[model samples]
Target: MRVKVEDLYFSYPGKDVLKGINLDLKETDIVCVLGPNGSGKSTLVKCIEGLQPPQSGNIIFDGTNSSKLSRIEIARLIGYVPQSSSQLFSASVFDTVMMGRKPHYSWRCSDDDIDIVADVLEQMGLANLSMNEYNCLSGGQQQRVLIARALAQQPELLLLDEPTSALDIAHQLEVMEIIHNSVHKRGIGVLMVIHDLNLASRYADKIIMMKDGIVFACGAPEEIFTKENIEEVYGVEANIFSHEGILSVIPVRRSDAKLVPESLGIF
Candidate 1:
């Protein structure tokens, strides 16, 4: 699916969170949103997913205005995987994944739903954990299960919020690889909020950098991941280098030179 956000405006009480935000995401594209805290990355994704509606502006999916669609209709088109959540119930992994089928089924699950869930679990490498209690899984495993549930929705677009948060390096790569494969094989458009610049540079086909509730820059990784842009958006000094078709970001320490007070918050 192709997603286009035009003049998107959102706010929280007295504060504006998204101001004139615009984006274009195409099928099979991996677009990552990068920004500091309070930059409206999460809010923007929530608005797109219909979890929260923008006060003004349009979210268009495949040339249709999202406001014309019902919440369930939108859910069917966009699958959202949130950051982290405490398991409120001890549902089995298979049952949890089956919940994604709700948007498509009104009554008991049919053979197609069962097959879809099973296929998703196998593709996500979660077949062995299907019957396990969801809460008992490790952080990485749980994250993968959440992703699997999203996949079972059969969405044309996937929205992920910090999919690698709290994961070790190996687990982070595992999750990113799953997302990468999904885009290339399933041809789904992915919009993710990622904190790690290096990870975003490595996996994202395009990067959207936001600052102070507006889009600061948006383009291919090489175009947007420059040292000047990094310092301007993130308030950090960093060296950006490429190795074997992947970019690596290394933040320069304050001890290397005299730094301002704001440098303390640099990521």
Candidate 2:
């Protein structure tokens, strides 16, 4: 599915969160939203999902206005994974994942739904945890379960909010790999809000940098992760480099003064 946001504007009672934002997402692209806190990254996802209506402008999904569609209709196209994976109940992993099929079902889950859920559990490496209590798992495992639930939705567009924030390094990479594979294999467009610039540079087909609820820059990782761009958007000094055809970002430490090491004289 394609997503097109044109002159989007959204605001709270006294605060303007999204200001005249515009973006176009294609089915083959993995777009990452890079920004510090309070940059409206989550709000942008909500707007695209039609959860929070934009104060002005239009959100077009696959040539249709998002606001004109029902929540179920929208769910048929977009699947959103929130930053905090929910494990509010003591439900088993299989049951929790089966909930994703709700949008497609009228009353009861069909044989196909069961098969899809089982397949997703295996794909996410949670087959063994199918009967385990969701709340009893590690953070990374819970994250994987949540993502599997989203994948079971069979959506054309996937929106993830900080999908790896709670995971360790290994699990983070694992989850990202699954997401990348899904997008590539299913032709699903993905938009993720991520704080890790290096991961973003490595995995994202396109990057959009936001500052104070507005876009600072938008382009490929190589074009958007320059020293000047990093300093301007993040207020930090960083050295940007390319390693084996992948962009790498390293933050430069700032200090007020240099210190000399003191050594004790021997004998």
Candidate 3:
């Protein structure tokens, strides 16, 4: 699937969140959105998923206008993984993942739904935990279960919000690797909102930097991860190095000499 966002605008009362945002995503590519908080990263993903409608402009998916589609219509083609998972219920992992098949089924789950859930659990290395309570899993294991649930949807587009935010270094890489493999092997487009610059540089086929509700830069990682671009978007001084074809971003210090943008206030 291909997604094209054109001249998109969105706002809350007394606040304009997305300003003429435009982005293109391809099924075989992994795209990462990097920006300071309140830069409209999550809002952009919500607009695309039809969770929050844009105030103006269009989101076209595979040549269809999103404004014409209903929420369930969009959900059939797009799978979203949020930043965190808090399973409050004691539902079995298999049952939780099977819920992703809801869009396809009008009644109870069929044999095909069962097969798909089993397959995804195996792929995520969670087959052993299929019967276990979802709420009992470790953080990393729960994350994988959620991803497996999304995959069970058989979506053409996957939107992930800070997929690794709560993970340790090893689990972070593991999650990213699964996403990367899905893009290459399953031919699904992935748009990830990530704060880790090094992880974005290493895994993303394209990187987009947003500042003040608009795109500051968009290109391949090598093109977008320049020192000046980092400083401009993040308000930080950083050394970006390329080692063995991989880029590593080492932030030296915040640019305290410059005033922080009002929009980025923690409150």
Give the Å shift of residue 201 in candidate 2.
0.6
Report the C-alpha lDDT of model 2 over 1-267, residue by residue, as the tens digit.
889999899998999999999998888799999998988999999899888989999999889999889999998888889887655568999998998898999899999999999999998889999999998988898888888888999999999999999888998899899999988988899999999998899899999999988888999998999988888787777888899989898888432113323353221
CA lDDT of each prediction against the hidden true structure = 0.92, 0.89, 0.90
On lDDT, the stronger of 2 and 3 is 3
Residue range 1-267, candidate 1, lDDT tens digits:
989999999999999999999888877889999999999999999999988989999999999999999989998999999997567878999999999999999989999999999999999999999999999999999999989989999899999999998899999999999999987888898999999999999999999999999999999999998888988888778998899988898988533345455667653
lDDT (10s digit) by residue, model 3, range 78-162? 9999887786667999999998899889889999999999999998889899999988898888889888888998889999999
**How many clashes in each candidate?**
0, 0, 0
Candidate 3 regions with alpha-carbon error over 4 angstroms:
257-267
How far does residue 255 in candidate 1 sit from its true spot (Å)? 11
- Superior by lDDT: candidate 1 or candidate 2: 1
Ranking by lDDT: 1, 3, 2
Record all residue pairs in model 1 with backbone atoms less than 3 Å apart, i.e. clashing. none
